[model samples]
Each structure stands twice: as structure tokens, then as C-alpha cells.
Target chain A: MIRFDQVSKRYPGSDEALRNVSFEIAQGELAFVTGHSGAGKSTLLKLMAAIERPSAGTVLIGNQNVSKLRPRIVPYMRRKFGLVFQDHKLLYDRNCFENVALPLYINGVTGQEAAKRIRAALDKVGLLGKEKAMPITLSGGEQQRLAIARAVVSRPAILIADEPTGNLDETYAAEIMALFHAFRQVGVTVIIATHDAHGISNIPGKMLHLDHGRLTVS
Target chain B: MKHWINQHTLVWRLVLARTCRNKLATLLIWTVIGIALCLPALLYVIIDNLNQLAGEVKHEPQISIFMKLDADKTIVDTTKSRLEKHAGIGSLQFVSKDSAWKQMQDDALTDNIATNLKQNPLPDAFFIQPKDHAPTAIEQLQHELQNWEGIEHVLADADWAKRLYSILELGKKAVWVLSGLLGFALVTIIGNTIRLQILTQREEIEVSKLIGATDGFIRRPFLYAGALYGFGGSLVALALINGIITIFNLSVADLAELYGSSFILALPGWQISLGITACAVTLGWLGSYIAVNRSLARLNPH
Candidate 1:
């Protein structure tokens, strides 16, 4: 579960990124936070993962107060959810299988057990046959799929994707949205931040809209 | 225990993967580190061998006292008694002038010459072995003997030993200085290599951090790489030194044979080899640790 009550984030020598934002998404719920550029969607997700502490109020992931969590515990806390980026942040030097295995490797699961999980995750995203292919060699859609496989490889409780389909075409964006829908059906809480509200509107999910650092609608 | 093993095994795998990724760079770094470490270690081995060789050339401190031929038996007896009472004397052999003349007459070349001489030219001498072989002790004994009654001269044949000892002392100091400088060079070499490695893996580190990888997890591979550098360098240094020593021994073998010396060069003992390897590995690990921590601190993942 993710909860944000009166959460605000401000950068030094700049205006506030998020102002008095309040929202809660229960376990297994799928939601989208949409706004224009510089609308603090990325900051809101960062607060959930404890990447950036809220300037005021509380951001709670489960029962833990993420804003006040110890620095040493931040990494462990992040393991509860997977994060995806717009650029597909896959390590280009390694093959697709290695990239997907990153989370499992970090979690100390390896050999046959890790291989099984990695293969299963890749198979779900239709990248099972391209396991040996390098990221640079993959198409734009396949790369985004590979990133999705990596995010769910560890079976994280929550999935937070920041503009994951920004670089893909209309068809690939719909495919990514369908993948998120399928993950929610399996009890994985999913939250996505994107500026293209209309593209994802056709999918059935709660929508939280933001405008100029203020939460305008939920 | 199981968790510990799994963690270490994964780290080692990562290290191997990265090392294999850039074979040329790894080899270059290892070679540079090996050369830096080899200089000091080579000097140490050479100094140790030289000291051992010098040790084999044993020289005992002995003072030879010459007495005047006209000295009376009474004065000679008194001088002998005084020497016998002295604590510095280990043993003394008194060779009388008549016996010295007789011994010279026994020789084939001096027999007829000694028979034609009316008086014996040889003087009574005492071969005095000192209790202590220290240079200062022997010098003190020689000075004390020169002031004794009926003694004309006291000669201590230990100048060569003194010079050799002084040279060995200077060599020890020189090895220390050289070792210190080379040690600093090794640390720098390892540190710079680790820094470059950190730069190359910057994105990987950032991604790992975001994906819930701890600082320890991100640093594990770099630490292993550093230790491997030190470990590999020490091995290469050892091999290089042994090869050079073998060649040196081959060239010097004939010279030693000409001198009729059974001396052969000795390789460093196992303990010393292990010590050098351990020292190098520790330095490498420390350098990598410092570099990785500094870079990690500078990166703000958020």
C-alpha cells in the first residue's frame, strides 16, 4: 500500500515541486498520475520510493514513514517495488537476460533459481527468445518490454513507472498499458506518471491529475 | 553462513564478469602494479642474499702481540700472567723465540739460512683470541695490549670485517627508503585504476542503487577487482624476481667456482613470499575501498 498525506517537496533555490499532495492507493490497485511538463509527477513517485524525502508531511509506504526513514534503510525499502524509466535504463553492455537478472542478482538469487525467474519474467513480456540480444540491438518496443520484465523480475509488491512509454509509438504504448493491467490483476500495485493522459484514459484505472505542483483532481 | 556464502559468490561472479569485459585494461593495470611492487621486493631479496653471503665469511677477532727480543724472562713471565688474568682474553698461545727459530729452521727454504745465523731474529709473540668479536671490543683490547710492558706492537686483523659490517648497515637503510617509495607508488597505481573503474561503471552503479542494491552490493565487485589486481601483481612480481635470480645465479656460478666458494644464491623463504603477497592484497583492497566510497558519496541517486 502507498499513502501520501499533505506531502510537499521543494528544491533549494527553486519553487516547490509538489505542494500539499494527498493521495492513497491500496494494495493491488492500479492508478495513473497525469500532468503536463514540470507537474511534479516524478517527485511524487520518488517520494514513494524514498528517493526524495517530502519537504513537509508524511509519505508512507505500508506502515513505514518513507520521509523519515533512515538513509541506510532506503535501499531495502526500494526492494518492495520496481521502478522503470522513460529511457529504458537497461545496462547496454550486457545482454537482455543479464539486464533482466539485475534485480535478482542484487537480491542474491542466482544459478537455476534465478534463471527460472528471469526466464519467466522475460517470457511474460514476449522477450524470452531475445534473451541473448543486446539492448542496442532491440527495437524501441522490445526495449521497453525488456525494461518491464526487469521491473517485475523480483516480484516486487508495487511497480512505479515514470513515462515508460514516452519513447515508444501508439501501439507500443497500448501494449505497455495492457502489461500494467495484467500485473494489477496479479495483485501488484501499479502507479505510472505520464503527461499523455488521453493515451492511457481508455484503460480502466483511477486517475490522479496534477497541475503546476498542485493536486487538482483524483 | 549460507547467506554469507551466496553473497560472496555473487560478488565474485560480478568481479569476473567485469574483468573479462576489458581484458587489455586489466592486464595493463596488473602489469603496472607488478612493476611497482617488484622493485622494492627485488631490492629486499638482493639485500638479504648479500647479507647471508657476508655472514658466511666468518672472521674471528684475534690480536697478535709482539714482544722485544731483549726483554728479560721475568718481564715476559709478568706480561703473560697479566694477560692470563684479563677477562677479555679467551685463549692465548705463547710462541717462544727459540721455538719460532726452530720452526723456521724446519722449513726447507729457511733451514740453511737459519743455521748460518748466529742469533735468532724472531721475537716471542702471543696469539690472543678475544672473548668478544665486536669491533670496538677488539680495538679496546689492542690499545690495552700496546701499553703493556715488553710489548712492541699489537695488531688486530679485523678492518675488513668492520668495512663489511658498515656496508651492510648502509644497505639496510637504503632498502628501507626504496621500499617506502615503491610502496607509495603501488598504492597510487592501484588507487588510480580503481578510480577509472568506478567512472566506467557509474551508470551501472546508479541503476543498481535505484533497483534496491545496497552500497555494499554496488561496491563488492570493485573491491574484488582491486584485490585481484594486488594479488595478480604480487604473483607476477614473484615470478619476475625468481626468473632474474635464476639468471643471476647462472652467470655468477662460474665466478663462484673460480673463487672455490660453494656459495649458491637462495630464493626468498615461503613466509616472506606470502607476506609480500598479503601486503600487496591489503593495499589493493584499501585503495579500492577508498575510491569507491568517495565516488559513491558524490553521487546523489535521487
Candidate 2:
């Protein structure tokens, strides 16, 4: 679960990207942040990730104020949440398996355990056969799935995706959402920040809308 | 311990693998380092040769002769020849009153009492050149020169040579210190480079962190990259130094032949190479640690 209390983010040489925004995401809940471009969707996501700090108020991730946490402890906080950007942000040079296995390797989960879990994540994303395939070779949908598999491979409790389905076709967008929904069903929280009405319309979850840096429940 | 080292080894492999992939970049960096490193190597050779030159000079006779103001030209000229035949004399010269006037004119301390003189008033003297310039040998030669009847004073010229030898010693010390500083700068350059790469891959880093990757695990490859750069640069620098040494040997050989000495320009002996390798490894390790620490700090998972 994550909570933002009166959080605001101001960029250098620009107006506030977000202002006094407050929201709470429930455990195991799948939700969407709906807004047009520059509606503070990305800022909210970055704040949640603690990549950027709030200008005002607190960002609480699992009862810890991530914004107030020491700089050295940020990696530990980051380990608890799997984040995906709109671009999939895959290391294009690496194959799907290595990408997925990166977190495991970082965490020192190597040998048979690493192999088993990597296979499991790849299998879960239906990328089992594409383990050795580079992200460039995978179709748009498969790349998004691979990103999601990478996100969940280490079993982070919270998954934050910034427009994971943005470049995907409708069919694949729904399929990716379905994957997020499956993860949500198993008690993992999901936050997807996107502007697509079609993408989140059928998803059964709360929809938080942002307009001019203000977040309001719709 | 074995498992820990194995894990570390894995990180090393990852760093080295990334370095291998960017061979061109690695080569360019190595070249930069090679150029920086070669300065000290060349200096080392110069200093070593100076040491050898000093050793050769130690065998030459050195004596100083004081003058007598009232000494007759005839007696001084006769005394000079007699001193030349002295047992330890390899060579000898007389500093006549006229020659002394010429030296004072060359020194040209204007507005002095010497400028008021019509006739040169300086005394005639003998400058003894001994068979051996070594301190003990020169001392013995000085004693012999002192016993000569017309020799007003006999001394050894210790001040100037000792001053120059001390300066060369300082130059030798500077080489070590300069090399250490340059090595540190290399680490920082490599560190900052790796840190920028990590920052550019922030999302990937965050994703990896969330997957429970330890900071060390994530940093392995960058560290390896640093080490690879350092090690490769050393080799290139060594090669450059060798090439320069080869070019230098032609004239060095000619001059050394004149001096009856043979010298070769070479890398610091094997132990020194070991030191170089250690420095390269340490720099890489430190660089990667710094890069990983800062990047991982900014990456938030929870």
C-alpha cells in the first residue's frame, strides 16, 4: 500500500508539476491515474518511486515515508516496488531472460534458484519461449510483458507502470492489463498512470484523475 | 569465504564483459591513461641515467686550488708543471692572474672594486685534477696537493655536486608522488563516467533494485569496467614508453659509448609492475563502488 499526503512537485525553471495532491492506494488494489499529457501523471509516479521528492508533504510507501528516508536506504525502499516506465526501459542489448534475471542477480539469487525463478517469470509473462530473444525482436506486447515480468520477478509487493500499454495495440493493451490484474489478484498492488480512456475503462478499479497538477477522485 | 569470493568474481566478470563489449571506448580511455602514465616512466629513465652519470663522475679526480696574491708568474708557472706530475694527477690547469681577471670579467659584477683596477690584481693559482673524484679518493688527493711546496691551499669541490645530487633526488621523489596523484585522478574519471552511465539507466537500476538485487551485485560490471580500463591503459602506456625508449636508444647508445657505459630503457622491474596492477585494480574497485553507491542511492524501490 502507498499514500501521498498533500504532495507537490516543482521542477527547476517550471511551475509545479503536482500541487498538494493526496491519495492512498489499497493493498492488492489495481488502479489507474488518468490524465492528459502534462497532467502530473509522471510526476506522481516518480514521487511514488522516490526518484523525485515532494516539494511539500509526505510520500509513504508501506508505512515508511520514502521522501524522508535517508539517501542510502532508497535502494532498499526501491527493492519493495517494481517500476516500469512507458518506454518499457528494457536494456535492449540484453535478452529477455537476462533483463528479467537482472534484479535476481543484483539480489545475489544466482545458480539454480535464479534459473528457476527467471524461468517462472518468463513463463508467467508467456515469454517462456522468448527467454533468449532480445526486446527488439519481441513484439510490442511481448516487450511490455517482459518489462512486467522483470518488475514482478523478484516479487515486489507494489508494481508501478507508466503507460505500459501506450504503444501496444488494443488487444495487447488489454492483455497487459490482464497480467497486472492477475498480479493484483495475488495481493500485489498495481498503479498504472495513463491518459487512455479505452485502456482503463473496463478495468475494475478506482480511477484517479489529475487536472492542472490537482488530483481528484472520479 | 569461497562463496563470497565467487559472488565477487561474478561481479568482476560482469564488469569485464561490459568492458569487452565496448572495446573501442576502452581503447580510447586506455590511450588517455597511457599518455598520462608515460610521463612518469620517462622521468624514471632520466633519473636512473642521471644516477649512472653521477656514478661515473665519482671516479673522476676533483681538487680546488686557493691563490697567493703576491706569487711570481715565473714561480707559479713552474709550480703548475710540478703539480701536474704529482702521483694522483690525471690532469691539471693553472688559474693565472690574467685568467682570474678574465673569469671576474665574465662574472661581470659591475660597480665593484675589480672594475677600478688597471692591471689584474688577482693571485695566480693551480686547479688540481685528480685520478679519482670519489669523496675518499678526492680527500687523499687533496692531502697530497696540500703537501706540495707552492700549493697555497688544497680543497675538494663538494658544495656544487652535492647540491645538484640533492635536486636530482627531489626529482626522483616527485615522480612517485605525481604518479600516485595521476592514478587517483584516473579513478575519479572512471568513476564519474560509470556513474553517468548508471544514472542514464536509472529505470533499469530501479527495476533491478526492486527485484532484490544488492548494491554490490548491481555494481559488479561497472567496477570490472574500471579495472579493465586501468589494466589496459597500463599495458598501452608501457608499450608507448617502450617505443619511446627504442627511439631514444639510438642517441643514448652513441652518448653512452662515448662515456664507456651501456644502458637500456625498460619498464619498472616486475615488482613495480605488480604495484601498477594493484593500483589499477584498486582504482577500478573504488570507482565502481562510488558509481554504484550514488546511483543506487537515487533509485527508490518501495
Candidate 3:
């Protein structure tokens, strides 16, 4: 579903962030992107999402050369994936249900269909009873689950979780990884960026470890 | 298409929703915008009324063509005939020298006979009412009448009208300039308000962008908020102008009565509505767009 053919990324500071990076994830594969801080894990995901362009080589998502995709189609391309972040990027003004409903809402789902989807997503994260609770009121783990629910409500073809369990306890982090495994079981491609070896190392999945800025796939 | 409209609808919906949630800030912002918008709109209406009043006065005043005392009776009769036949004369009356003297005698009786004499000095006159009586109109007619044959002088009672009209014109122009400056102030006020809002939402914007929400999605509501600033401000201004007119209408009527005339206050018409609405929408759209785009650009979603 995603292919980075010898991709390289450079930021405006004249510093090379990603150099000669190459990777491929077959459809429905579950994988971990393991790296230390600033090891290009975030940069690779950003390139795949077309947030930042590669300085050299091409990045392909769904067989389309997103490297050459015009500016306008970028948003449409993004609608195909779910993204979870370590920060639980939920709107503070909105309740848990509303935050989870956002992706589907942007996709033009409404009325009975949207409510039903939001309930199911929230329910999957074990947050069914807390729909009306505001993000500011939720615990850290609950907020993380809400962000995950928001990501998966649209059932996007690919899931990119950037340290989705970064700030959680080992118990909560494993729970989050189990949810990602459930998605992979349903044939959705999943790639998680994290250094949580203590919590997620025992889980069965391909691990792509990065040192400096180059990936070592195993 | 319904799809496109829904996408765009988020901008407006979010604005209103946020306003409802955060009423105090929204209200304060709207009030600032209203004050700015109201000044210009009120001036525009007053200037319009001034123009109308000027038009009315232009069609009401007349001049008199006084014949020379040395001129013959035949010349006076011929002059009266020429004045009567002229296009400039809305109406003309041949006031014989005797009647002119009688009018002076009657006026003198009201005063004292001792001061009345002075040799029945009034001359035979042709009272020429021009087609238009505005200050400028009468002045033009005065020059044309002076060139007529057998007439020694042409004088129109238009000095005060000319001075008042010119003064009012200048006042109207001043109002226009003041309103324009106020319009700029309104834009700046709303732009600054939006800028602050952008600053407050910086973290939320970074989250949205990082999650793949496009810049347009994040900006939709802000644009709507800016539009509402202008729209709400305009409506407030409309109310303000109406209130001012209501409070001053009776006094204005009383002032006009001093001139032996009645005056009425008129409500604004469709023109004012169109002008205010257009000004509001333009300001709102531009202000929000600028604030949203700049802030969003600075936010690195990654």
C-alpha cells in the first residue's frame, strides 16, 4: 500500500533529515517503525502522507506517485488514511464522540450513519459510555483512545500511528497495540512509530528499526 | 452541488458554533465592528439626504430684472415681452413703477412716513421665476438676465442659499471621508481579533494539519467568523443609525419650522442595505482569510 523508493528528505535548515530511505509495506501488513529520537521515523511517515516532499527519489501511496501529485489533490489523498498522534490531537471544545465523528463528518457522512459509526469506533476503544465527556476531562489513556477512535471511525485504508501509545503505561500501551492488531486482522495496513520495546516487543509483527536516518527492515 | 456546499458549510457552521460557545469574545468583537461600520453608513445616509435637499432647493427660487429709469415705456413693454417669451422664466410679472412705489409706500407706512419719501425710488421690475431656483441655477439665470435688452440689472435673492448649500456639500464630503477612515479601522479591528484567535488555536491547528486536515478545512470556520463580524456589525450600525434618527427627528423638525417649513426624517432604503451588506461581507472575508492563511502557514503539522 505504501512504497518509498530510495526516498530522501531535506528541510530548509540545510540539514538532511532522511537519506536514501527505501521501504515497502504489502497490503494489510502490520509493522512497527522503531527508532530513537530524530531517527527519521516521523520524517518517513510525513513523506508517506505527503506532508513533506522527498528531496530525492519518489514516494508512492496506493500506486500513485504522490511525489508528483499537484497541491490540490493532497487533501483528497489524505482522506484515505487514519492518523493517530502521541498528543491526542482532539479539539478541546468538542466531546469525545464529536472528535471521533470528525473524520466521517469531513467525508460527508451524516444523520444516522455518522452517529452509528462514531458509537462503534468509540465502543471499540472501550469508550462507549464516555461519549459526552470532553477531552480535557478525560484521563491521558482515555484521551489517547479517543484519538484512536477518531482515526479509525472513517475506516481508512491505512493507519499511521505516530507514537500512539507514547505517554501511556505498559498496560494501556499494550491495549492500544491490541487495537492496532485488530485493525490489521481486518486487512487494514498498520505501521506504528514508537520506541516502546518494553510494551510492544513481544507482539508478533515486522519491525523496521532505524538508526540515524536509515531503516533496517527485519 | 450538495457535496461542495456541505464542505463549505463547515466554515460558517463552525463560526456560529464557536460564537455560541464563546459568546463574550464574539460579542465584544462584533461590537467593535459595529461601531466602525455604523459611522460610514450613517454618513452615507446623511450625505444622500443632503443631495436630495440640494435638488429640492434647486427648483424653488426666482430673480427680478429691474428696467433702467431712463428707458422708455415702449422699451419696458418690449423688455417685459422678451422676458415673458424667454425659456428661463417659469413665471414673470410686470410690476409697473407705480405698483413698485406703492409697495414701498405700504412698507414705509408700517415704519414712519418721515423716512418713507426718497422720491418713490423703486423701479419698474420684471419678476422672473426661473425654471430652477438652486443657488447655482439662480446665479446662472442672473447672468443671462443681465444680458437681456432694456434691462439695467438682474438681482436674485440667493446669497444665503448659495452659502448654505456650499457649506452642506462640504459637510457631506467630510462625512464621506470620515466614514472611509472608519471603515479601515473596522477591518483592522476584526483582523486583529482574528489574529488573536489564530494565536489561541495554534496548537489545535498543528494537530489538524498533522492529522491530514488541509489548510482549507482548518480555516473554514475563521472565515465565517470574520464574515459574521462584518454582518453583525452592519446590523448593529443600522440599528444605531435608526436610533439616532429617532432621537433627533423632532428637533430637526423644530429647527426647520423656524424657517416656516416642515421637515421629515426618512428611514434608509435598499441602497443603504446593499452598501452596508457589501462592505461587511468584503471586510469579513478578507480579514479572516488573511488571519487564517498566515497562521496556518506557520503551523508545521509534522
lDDT of each: 0.88, 0.78, 0.80
Better of 1 and 2 by lDDT: 1
Interface RMSD of each: 1.6, 4.2, 2.9
Question: Candidate 2, residues A117-185: lDDT per residue as tens digits?
Answer: 999999998999999888999888888899888888889888999988898888898888888989989
TM-score of each: 0.88, 0.71, 0.84
Q: Output the worst ten-in-a-row residue range by lDDT, candidate 1 chain B.
A: B54-63
Which lDDT tens digits does candidate 1 get at residues B80-178? Answer: 999999999999999999899999999987899998999999999999899998888898999989988899989987778668878888888987898
Interface RMSD of 3: 2.9
What lDDT score goes with residue A171 in model 1? 91
Candidate 1 structure quality by residue, lDDT tens digits, A17-87: 99999999999998999999899989888888878888898988999998777888889999998898767
Give the clashing residue pairs of candidate 1, or none. Answer: none
Would you give me the overall lDDT of model 1? Answer: 0.88
- How does residue B263 of candidate 2 score in lDDT? 61
- CA deviation > 4 Å runs, candidate 3: B1-13, B59-63, B68-75, B78-122, B127-153, B156-172, B300-302
Task: Write down the lDDT that model 3 would get.
Answer: 0.80
What local lDDT score does residue A89 receive in model 1, on the 0 to 100 scale? 84
The TM-score obtained by model 1 is 0.88
TM-score (C-alpha, index-matched) for candidate 2: 0.71
| Candidate 1 error regions (>4 Å) | B1-7, B56-64, B68-75, B86-141, B157-163, B254-259, B300-302
